[model samples]
Target: MTIDALRHSPEQLRARIAAELERARNRSTGLTDAVDGDDLVRQHSPLMSPLVWDYAHIGSQEELWLVRDVGGREPVRPDIDNIYDAFQTKRADRPSLPMLNPDEARVYVSTVRDKALDVLEHTPLEGRRLVEAGFAFGMIVQHEQQHVETMLATHQLRQGPAVLDAPAPPPGAPAAETEVYVPGGMFLMGTDLDPWALDNERPAHAVGVEPYWIDTDPVTNAQYAQFIADGGYADRRWWTPEGWAHRSNAELTAPQFWHDDGTRTRFGHVEPIPPDEPVQHVCWYEADAYARWAGKRLPTEAEWEMAARYDPESGRSLRYPWGDEDPTDEHANLGGRYLQPAPVGAFPKGTSPLGVRGLVGDVWEWTSSDFTPYPGFAMFPYPEYSEVFFGPDYKILRGGSWAADPAAVRATFRNWDYPIRRQIFSGFRCARDV
Candidate 1:
């Protein structure tokens, strides 16, 4: 079916949903299958779960939402639901749980997927909010894809030979300017019409922003290296008191995985740091300190969104930086096509109307904004997805990374984490007052 047909026809929507479900499963299995049973069952790091847990948890979520809730079908594995409950179980403790083993997890997920597809066939696409426009299926697709990204991060942290491989990203183009000026004005900041946008990104509202200058592309490794060379990490003036305390306690002198000799680990291979690629694995504190050392600051969430989605002449926010259309390989480096971020300024086609580039793919850009609900926000489907995490304790990150799936990210999508986290694929650009 044509991509557009899925929006109007029930049969086409079901087909699209099935394709997405299968695609997510392929990525999940590919990551797990590359390693042995021990690797799958062992927790690579305390920050993430055992690969086997994620595998079975994905199946449990599908069964809970699609089979039991949406399809009114009997439970496939009611006995292990609590063991896989993310909110109830912590990552550090999941390895000790009596979760399914690698072999059993594979079978459990396969059975759940078959039942989910059956539900998709019988359930009407209209009526309730969850199933409307195939939102539930879309949510599940996004959920699985998110876990895939998390699994990729765990793989990065694994201590051993690299088992993953992918072609290098395309070379970058020369940027005409270092920074682009965004005029002060009002723009719609979130989504109201997007069927799959999570609760935090809903009820689009107008936000008034002031004129500012934002980097045309994300800050590059070479530029960040300058900050390190200038003793940015040791200089107390560059970091907030909280940031300085964490940096001192953790002894963080460079981005995670960097060696004092100027080489860094990528996947598992040691190589010279790519000067042109966007810096990855940086915490918000590090990004903020680097920005301060450069006499700039991280962009606020509103400013970042404005630069990414607003078109001054049209006075409308496009669904993505380039335009109101879904992402493709040419537009952004996404869907694990490349294991690492494309070089800054690589995807000219993905540039926003204001000439800001690389806003959608490469790394999750840290913003100064705290994670909070938008005006008129309401809980939907479940509150655990977003509501429970809303507050200043979490900082916001925008855009998608190379590991992120296209279905899981958009201009309006929101990701949040503690400010001290550096394991995720993250980076940032700078902005300044005009």
Candidate 2:
């Protein structure tokens, strides 16, 4: 089913929601089931919560929004609410908390799903802000899918043999051009019409971007390797003061999981780094440095959005790079269809009107922008989701990763992380002013 299927008739929308919920749950369970109970409870990395926390946390949120708030039903398991509250507890401290055991977490989430499904059946699809067009349900589905992606990242960090498996992504024809030119003009930056879009992506506003050139496809591993080969890490000239400081302190010679033998570990398997594939696990600092080394700069958030969504011919922003239609396998490498990013230019059909490719998926692209709210931004449902993170402390990443779920990702969707963080599946393309 399409991600925008939520806008259909009540009957079709119900079925679509149910299918998406099931799809997300299957992913959550599949990842958790691959390892033993011990693995689920143990924190794989301080950067991520235990897999079990995510499991129950998914259900806790579903129950809070769907069962209690939407349905006006009694809580399924109020005792564990604090345990899974992300804001109340941080990732590093979660493993120490009284979180539910693996078996208990499974049972709790299952129980909550049953109640949430019942609420879905009875809840009206109109009137209220949250329920209108089943926004609440869509939000829950996206929430669960987001956690599922997080679990996938945790799996990548866990020690041992590869427990996950997926076919490699399709190869791509070499791009005829390295960079696509975007004309300077005004285009709607965000979305006010998209019902399921998070609050941060709402209230679409006009943004005037300067004409610039963006890489047609994400920067490849070979390109980044060249940066490293040229003493990019040792040279401070290519890096910002902050980036150089972090690089020195961390002794980051290459992207995370990369080894000296010209190979990288992916999902516990060591393989030669594919020169054609987009580089992943690099932080904002690394991407920025690489851009500087190449005599380019990371695209600003507005520039990135313009490249991904603005249709100069139509003078309107499309929902995705390809068009307003929801993403399909042919559109991008999304929904964990492949465990790793496709080769750059693999999804030609996903290319934007301006000939930019790989904007929807593969790896989250770091943009040279702070994680700030749009003009006239307002928090919805809660403040912790977006409002609290607004500032220069976090750098924004555009485009979704291969690990991202389609329902949770869009051209306007904004993801932010600390500049020093390298755990996320992130890559970047260079841009230069015309």
Question: Which predicted model would earn the best lDDT?
Answer: 1
Tens-digit lDDT track of model 2 for 1-434: 34466558888888888988999999999998999988999999999999999999999999999999999999988998898999999999999999889899899989989998899899888999998888899899999999988999999999999999999889887899999888878999999878789999988999998899999999999999999899999999999999999999999999999999999998999999999999999999999999999999999999999999988888999999888888888999999988999998898899999999899899999999999999999899789889999999999999999999989999989999999988899999999989
Residue pair clashes in candidate 1 = none
Pairs that collide in candidate 2 are: none
lDDT of 2: 0.92
Q: How accurate is candidate 1 locally (lDDT)?
A: 0.92
Q: By TM-score, how accurate is candidate 1?
A: 0.98
- Cα deviation at 277, candidate 2, in Å, is 0.3
